[model samples]
Target: MATEREIFSNSGPLDLTAVDWTNSQHRRTVAASLVQGTYSMEHDRQQKLQGHLALGPPWWEFFNFQPVQVLVDEHDLSIFGAIFKFKFPPSYGNYLPQNPPQYVVAFRGTITKTDTKKQDLKLDFQFIRNRLHQSTRVHLAMQAVQNMVSIAGAANIWLAGHSLGSAIALVAGKNMVKMGCFIETYLFNPPFTSVPIERVKNEKLKHGIRFTTSVIKAGVAIALNSQHQRSQKDHSFNILSGWIPYLFVNPSDPICSEYIGYFEHREKMMEVGIGNIARLATQNSLGNLILGATGKDSEPPHLIPSAYLTINVSPTQDLKQAHGIQQWWKQNINCQFKLHQYR
Candidate 1:
């Protein structure tokens, strides 16, 4: 962990792009509150089989993120696998009017269940195909965010989620983009949208670039960013409209590494010409024969968009705490933000 006065870096020589340190720290701090809400959901469940909480008073004091509110009210959100949702101040942009505070929404990841966590991951993949709303859990989250935005008339409604929650955030953010809503996302150890490549039944048939119709559009936007100042507004899908994403991941964590790193891998490959060739060659049915090939783990047509700062960490300092939010904070508390050459 790097101190406030120090720069955050990796053990290796990866030249990292930095983010706005104060704002980055604030997002992590907000993420911490949402993390606590997850634990409270679990304990409250054990006691009375409850599903949501208000997270007020003393707890919000610790983070000093005041005037907080939890949307969805007394209604239980567990059936949708959206265990918890919280409202806090946005890290970017200002409100149209000062009456309502500019706000952001954070979602709690899946609770232990075949239905909640596992199920949402399957639905998350459809995000690129333009099919995210098909999932009930995701649809519910989207509605909640939309409703919150409507009530607050939030100039910008930022979304953050962990694990499956992060995936939901990505999908919902995409939908928000389509609506031309102002938004930003922070994903904590977000999972990739596809299963392992080895698991594909007919590997030979599916080989080549995993570029989905939409994923290709996103890839091109990223390749351009590697060389120019194209903002999200310039991207075809509106992915680069204002700012790129703020991503936090453990490099070796299987959920994100073996699975989710696909989006990251695709960006790197395309920046080097794999995407261009994949786009050009595929025009020939036979040229498509060469197959651009998906990441060792990513899906083609990577639609989640780009990252302003992809903060890679090794918080598995204690193996037991590898994916734990506490570990994530313990590692990120001493944080820094900078501009590195785009990866």
Candidate 2:
């Protein structure tokens, strides 16, 4: 109650351009727990963000971000995302961090197949870009990013996503960098593309990908999501230097199961649970969907041969182990190994 009252007394909800979750050590610790595929701890972290917690590993004094504004549609909560700004806590300048933190934009992924409109939007984002956000609350978040650049001169930014969100991050990264901002994007289990990876590089963006441990195990065939079965790469596999794409794969993911070695060190080994397992199953269901949801002829463009994976084991158990956000935090980030360096 006190927390709510204090928030109400504030000038406004947290501003998106000022708070940086990336700089919070405590936040990173909680994210690491999620990477280990623990959703309970992740929920606690979310509650902390909501200011419902009385105490935790650290106080708000060291907090790196605030609620700011979450972009969501009034009618449907599923079709929404959020934008968070970086806030320098007290003593922040005393202990100068290595790099200046930037704003983070997180696009939520699809969890259920019940919402047909939301499902169509994901398809459009993947297959066509006639209109994204479609006057939805995301426009407000995009406007905030514009203010961060044109108004605040904060050029550094980080883009992140999961499942369908990863696909969205790619587009956002492309647009932001073209705006002349240095953008670093992290994609957790982005869908595969038979279209030469080089083709996307022509668009000029540096990004990273993460997957499950089972996907990396021997004998699992890999495949990308296919929105339009007709869409394919005009050229063969041609590696390009301009776009640096790092892939992180763990165990048992239906979408990103195996790494065919796009590049050395591009793929990293990682380590997940029921909430996570449930999510993995949900992601698997994506395969049979989109086609039905959007009334398209085919499922979202899954690459030939893959985005294809040869699953020898029970899909439930296999998909249970997913390469989503949690493993990315545990292995690629907040880990003693610091495997990201290799990428």
Top candidate by TM-score: 1
Model 1 shows how many backbone clashes? 23
Give the poorly placed runs of model 1, Cα more than 4 Å off.
1-21, 49-61, 64-101, 113-132, 154-156, 194-243, 258-275, 278-302, 315-320, 331-343
lDDT of 1 at 131: 47
Report the number of the highest-lDDT candidate: 1
Q: Write the per-residue lDDT of candidate 2 for residues 1-343, one digit (tens) a residue.
A: 2222122123112222233445533333222221221122222333444344532212222235433445444545433444555566675668655454345555545543344366535554544333343434335545656665664454465555555555555555544544556454455565553222322233223122223322321111113334332122211111111223333333255354333322211322312222232222212223333343455333222221111111122222344345444334321232221222211
Candidate no. 1 TM-score: 0.57
Give the Å error, residue 1, model 1: 30
Q: Give me the runs in candidate 2 sitting further than 4 Å from their true place.
A: 1-63, 91-93, 113-144, 152-154, 193-247, 257-317, 331-343
